[model samples]
Target: MTSMSKSKTNNGNGTVDSRRQEVQRIVKNACDQLNSEGVDARNYVEQLAWLFFLKAFDEAETRREEEAAFDDAGYERRLSGNFAWSSWASKTDHPDEMLEFVDGKLWIKLTSPDPKKGLGDDPLAERFRR
Candidate 1:
């Protein structure tokens, strides 16, 4: 993951400090909501970690894809379609569908050792297996 110091997101208007505050506010709200639903701090944090990791992975892949396009080279994505965060997580209006996809297909692809069922033999897939 890139360092926050190296890259500051202004969200197209606000300063870095304001963006930080906005993120903190969002996180606090999410924590409060999860607490009300009986999810402990540790559990919610763990789930958030998975989300953040996937988002970062998607961002990195996007960067690589752009570079490949600029260089006129072929770049195959590690994940695509419903397995990608862009394909699944971006559709916030369909929470039920997103949840079903995550539980039904995404988890299977990430965890299944059978190459036909999972991410094949990539280094990232090997790490997931561990």
Candidate 2:
């Protein structure tokens, strides 16, 4: 029988690399979609933050529901009307106010360590920083 050589593998490092690539891919896709929709390419970073915040909020809510019985009051308490892009955009006729609302939510989500309804650590915070 021929001798077999074993190849060493770094699963942990591979996992990290995989995750990094996945995040990059997601950001790229989001940017592409935004561009296709006629949004300014420069706004990709802002859009990324907004999408990330929405996704994180949805995931956190799902987790909460699975972990505990559904609580309408708790759900309502955690809801952030500002999370809705269209709603926030319409809040003020001025572009500055719209940008402010979006930026404010982005900052809150990025800084919060704990899951708070509309608040949580932004998953795309790293991308935004870059």
Candidate 3:
């Protein structure tokens, strides 16, 4: 195996190995569920990747905002309010509600940017616009 793969799969700790296995199992279960619904592995993985990307972006933006606040500097957020993952994902309790938000509002916000609607001209938002 490549050194990178080996390093990732064998971290020289039983606890890490067990946790890795658990994560793998959870991802596999998710993939299986999507597959059962006629979603191909590639499509499901891409969707998962998009969700993960948005979540990570939100976390990084939060950190940057905090740092700017501490320094008494202004920090413009790329995602906030309902566009933020924390707000939409956590606040929407029901599956149907979440789906509706994603399919309707979230999709429009991401795919069709409108400065008038507050999906501003930030770098990340501009990328989505393109």
Candidate 2 lDDT tens digits, 1-130:
2232112234446776677789899778967878899989776775566566766666686677555654443433143455544345455568787677657774564445444433335444434454
Candidate 2 error regions (>4 Å): 1-17, 32-39, 69-130
**TM-score for each of the candidates:** 0.75, 0.36, 0.68
* lDDT (Cα) of model 3: 0.79
Model 1 misplacement above 4 A: 1-19, 113-120
Cα lDDT of model 3 by residue, 33-87, tens digit:
8889998887777667778788788989999999999999999876778888998
Candidate 1, residues 1-130, lDDT tens digits: the string is 4666445552354575686788789889999999999988988787788887888899899999999999999887777777889999887899898898888988777666555545565566665666
> In model 1, what lDDT does residue 64 have?
96
Local distance difference test scores for all models: 0.79, 0.58, 0.79
Q: What is the C-alpha RMSD of each candidate to the true structure, in Å?
A: 5.8, 10.5, 4.3
Query: What is residue 59's positional error in candidate 2, in angstroms?
Result: 1.0
Better lDDT candidate (2, 3)? 3
